[model samples]
Target: MSMPPVKKIVTWLLVIFLLYAIFTSPSDAANIVGSAWDVIANGVANIGRFFDSLIARS
Candidate 1:
């Protein structure tokens, strides 16, 4: 009934859901992680290019 207990219940529910997803559809989880990593890699590459352009200008 209180806020803290409610939050804990929701958190546990999400953990269960994630565990179910991971066990039930591992390939889909792998794809999701791969796509996320790709996005992060591309962002870092773009930042490196921006710094390189800045250095070239100076």
Candidate 2:
């Protein structure tokens, strides 16, 4: 609410924004992979749920 505290908050916010911009630049890259693993994880979860339902009904 006071002037000094408001100025400090604005300065800190500016510093954080600059740091984030430096990290996420296009020069960095990733080794890409297919979505097969995602699909497999989902499939296993579905199978577990199916068995759980069967046991619940018995």
Model 1 worst lDDT run, 10 consecutive residues: 1-10
What stretches of model 2 exceed 4 Å from their correct place?
A: 1-34
Error of 2 at 22 (Å): 27
lDDT of 2 by residue, 1-58 (tens): 5579889899999998766765675233221223556678899999999999999999
| Colliding pairs, model 2 | none
Best by lDDT: 1
The CA lDDT at 57 in model 2 is 100
Give the per-residue lDDT digits (tens) of candidate 1, residues 1-58. 5579889899999999999999999999999989999999999999999999999999
lDDT of 1 at 53: 100
Indicate the residue-level lDDT of 51 in model 2. 100
The CA lDDT at 7 in model 1 is 92
lDDT, model 1? 0.96
